[model samples]
Target: MYGCEWDDETGATNGFFQDGYDGEDFLSLDLKEMRWISPVQQGFLTVQKWNKDTANTEYQKQYLSTVCIEWLQKYLQYGKSSLQKTVPPHVSLLQKSSSSPVTCHATGFYPNEVKISWMRNDEDHDEDVDLGELLPNEDGTFQKMSTIRVTPDELKKNQFSCVVEHQGKTIKKTLTDDSLPIGIIVGALAAVVLLVVISVVVFKVYQKKKGFKPVSASDDGSNSSAHSDAKA
Candidate 1:
């Protein structure tokens, strides 16, 4: 139910309008595609509901349902436009620490119209990347692969990204390193800190027991009196 042309110059879809507005307990096409809706799935729909007495904004269930139906009717009538005009953009992140190669492939394109490049921290990759051939599809679409041989030092910046340009727009998706698993690292650090705290508590108890010696004052006084009598 998307890609509904607005006017002559702006043939873009009205999907953005639906995106801006929201409804409650109502029917919807897809989030992006905005496909068609069925009558069977129409009943029990609730959009923005209002009070009959006060005529104020009471519940939004009935209101959203009405909006969805109106948008769907217009969407079906003007949704005949083709999605083939713009090439679908895609980027993959394949991480490899081996000496072989790190390759990423992207498909769903309108051949020769989309351009892709490999970059390491926004710099042009010269000797590292090996560009692959573009394969064509039955619908005149194309797919391409780009590979880069990254060194251990190059991966230190932790900012490798793939840049794709098509239809006067640029999009990028960053690559993540396999060596760094955030959850595991945090768990290991927590375990180490717990062990250190337990060890410190155990050491304090051990020292208190070893250094303690109990004595009575009456025994010392009697021994001193007997020693004074012997001296007299």
Candidate 2:
């Protein structure tokens, strides 16, 4: 296999080639350090090493130098744009924490740089807001939440809004008393259904384990017939 590993944060990179599993030391490079730690840096040196000859380690030095330069140029030119593209976040109301507490959820956005806060009657409200951390999404995006407690009286007197800033855009989602996010509602219902199903399965398993059996329809009918005959 032939490929390179580059770390954007520390500017560390390595380029290497391997012939096969349990193969001879072929070509390896610490491109960032500009050092040859093991194996020959050139294909010819690799061939020489494989054949047990005195190998020229820098035989591929010029080529590796060129690769390093190109790598730096790519990072300088297109690194930020390659994996740093922005995606607008979806904002919605989460399930309320209490009768008065409402949470605003923002999800599925890249870059993870987001601002979440509350707005009361078109004014910035921060003292009561509880902002959550940037949680990673399975899709490599991010999710976050911010909650605020507003009483029914205050909600009736003033409008409450969650302002989310991400991807160079501002999203203002209004908080409502009884409305939960559609995703949250569906997830909750699915969870409850799953719990009920699991409970039933567990109950059946426990009953079987205890040698308890359910009465069949015929057995119930037989018992009813015996009871009627006894009364007669």
Error of 1 at 111 (Å): 4.7
Model 1 per-residue lDDT tens digits across residues 1-232 = 2233334356433332222123432333332432322234342232212122222221232333455456655665685454335677566655434334566767777635766776666776556777888888677677787777776556665566777777787778666655543445667899999999999799789878899443333558776677666668
Report RMSD (Å) for each prediction in the order shown: 19.1, 12.1
Question: For residues 72-113, what per-residue lDDT tens digits would candidate 2 score against the true structure?
Answer: 657767767747688889997865343546879999988899
Each candidate structure's count of clashing pairs = 15, 0
CA lDDT of each prediction against the hidden true structure? 0.57, 0.72
Candidate 1 regions exceeding 4 Å error are: 1-84, 95-99, 179-232
The alpha-carbon deviation from the true structure for residue 174 of candidate 2, after best TM-score superposition, in angstroms, is 0.4
- Global lDDT of model 1: 0.57
TM-score of each candidate structure, all chains considered together: 0.38, 0.49
